[model samples]
Target: MMNLCYNMGADLWNLLRTGGSEMKLLICVLNDTDKLDELMIKLAEAGVKGATIINSTGMGRTLYNHQESALMNSLRALLDPDRDENKTIFTVVDEAQEKAFHKVMNEVVGDLARPDSGIIFTIPVDSVTGLSK
Candidate 1:
């Protein structure tokens, strides 16, 4: 069973590293939940195979809401009072797919430069297991 698990993990790693391109773990902190459906559609259109979406809240949101201290109150002004929670999406993509992801994300979520547009970034992935093609 251990050897079988090892072989399966190796296969998954190879699948992720196909085409000699490095894999990246793309993370997007989407402030607006309204755009989630559209974003998922756009990602699928862009050939993104899979993703994991998590309901999340920023530290500022938590602190501002719970803490009544002077500093927390001051920080509250910096945060958007309207939105309390955020949706964070994670996916793995190759170099080419990363570009496609960026394009589709911008199309659905608007420019990251603008306020409330959300933040997107990527981290290098060394190996992956249990990610099926």
Candidate 2:
């Protein structure tokens, strides 16, 4: 169910093991920016360099903290009606930094990856490239 949208499509093997950073193929469900800032500050205190974010949305409901706005619902019919308010973030992150990212999410966001936290999981780019850059 992992939708890997790559800028350049090659043989399926390339997707199995991501090495280099591609344009924009991987997905990431980032936590709240405020919490993210706090997380970064903590990481900064710990000597982390930096990180980035992309304004994105997801399909499920009650799956993330940042719910889908009313406007987004009108724009796309992909949301689940019966579920709680539509909220979930989609994102991409570095594979090597996966554990650290999750640690931040768990400590800062508290259940960001939980089923009803309204935030899904961040994906790794096996070979991401050309992410609308």
Best by lDDT: 1
Per TM-score, the best of the predicted structures is 1
Residue 130 shift from truth in candidate 2, angstroms: 12
Local distance difference test values of all predictions, in order: 0.83, 0.46
lDDT by residue (tens digit), candidate 2, 1-133: 1344433445353553344433222233543444555766664454333445555444443354347676776545456432333223333444434555556557776875465443445443455444321
lDDT of 1 by residue, 58-99 (tens): 887787578578776566657855467789999998888899
C-alpha RMSD (angstroms) for model 2: 10.8
What TM-score, computed on C-alpha atoms, does each candidate reach?
0.74, 0.38
